[model samples]
Target: MQLLIVTAHPETQSFNFAMRERAATVAARVGAGLSFSDLYQQGFAPTPGRADFQDFPATQSFDLAQAQKAHQQHGGFALDIQAEQEKLEQADAVILQFPLWWGGYPAVLKGWIERVLSYGFAYGRDKTLPAKKVLLAVTTGGIADEQDAQRSQARLQAMADDVFGYMGWRILGLHLVHGPADLDAEQRAEALNSYAERLRLWLSEAVPLAA
Candidate 1:
């Protein structure tokens, strides 16, 4: 199975990076092929423009294929939507890992979803991907209790339903680890163990790779 992990954190040694590493490592151990795109590290450009709405060889009626072609033909990532769609197609499971900033995902990650989950690609009348398949988010927030359903989970899940599920990608999971950086040594170890366990369960149930 192919699992794509998307991380949007600036610090290489941050807890977000560690969670990403742990996720990739366990997924690999469980026999799934692991691939990742570190947005900040890759220098992903998070901007939308007019060319993103172009219609030359094809009409501008929500054609992801055309948008992708236009992006490559024009330049690198004229829109974040096209870039992420390419990644979304290549993976059986997608993990969006980022720190919750200001009650939501970092601006870059949000921009990625806003621009990449386009009309025809992520959602439209005849979109091809399966429902809840993409596995919308893997995120961390400093505040623990506040990340609950009453606080932000419902809103976030609704957004996921609208964006990824609407696009026909089953949300295989939504793992939110708390206090990634604020944890002490013991807490860090416990956090890692918890994350590893959850990830292991996910792979065992969903991924079909050789042991």
Candidate 2:
């Protein structure tokens, strides 16, 4: 099995980093080929526009979707965008890891999707990418039961439904690690171990780790 993990966080030493590493460990145990895209480390461009397109006319109005569609036909998306698309195309499952920023995906991750998941590739075709499972593994600013965490989970689920679900992919699960940064060393390790166990089920065993 092939698993693709995309992480968006600025600090290399942050808990989000550890989270992805924990995921990798599970991927390894499960014997899945792991593909990682660390946005900041890649210096990925977060904006989508004419620069990302190849054949679109500069003089014409730039419609993001139309431009993406054009690239699907003419084949001119930037190298970085193409690389990310390739990873997603190969993944049997995908995990998006990042902190819950403003109750949504970090702009970098959102832009990565926008620039990479082009038209016809993400939708508007008979067989886009095969139906793969997607998991939303996010870190929260507070405990999961906090009002904010509840709302964030709802919003993230809605996003998964509209984006991945609409693309015909299954939503595997959403793992929320609350206040990871605030945890003591022992607590943090315990949380990571718990996450690893869940990852073991989700990525390796193809089972949803019940919340």
Backbone N/Cα/C clashes per model = 12, 0
What's model 2's overall lDDT?
Answer: 0.84
Worst 10 residues of 2 by lDDT: 202-211
Stretches off by above 4 angstroms in model 2 are 144-148, 207-211
* Model 1 misplacement above 4 A: 51-83, 128-132, 136-141, 144-150, 208-210
The sequence of per-residue lDDT tens digits that candidate 1 reaches over residues 94-187 is 8788877777778888767766665545566655443435554445455546546355667667766766766667776676666566779899
CA-lDDT, candidates in order: 0.68, 0.84
lDDT by residue (tens digit), candidate 2, 1-211: 8899999999989999999998988887777889999998999999988989756676999888877877777688888888998898899899999888877889999898788877877777733656778888898788545686678778889988978888888888998888887899999999999999887877755734334
TM per prediction: 0.78, 0.92
lDDT for 121 in candidate 1 is 51
| lDDT top scorer | 2
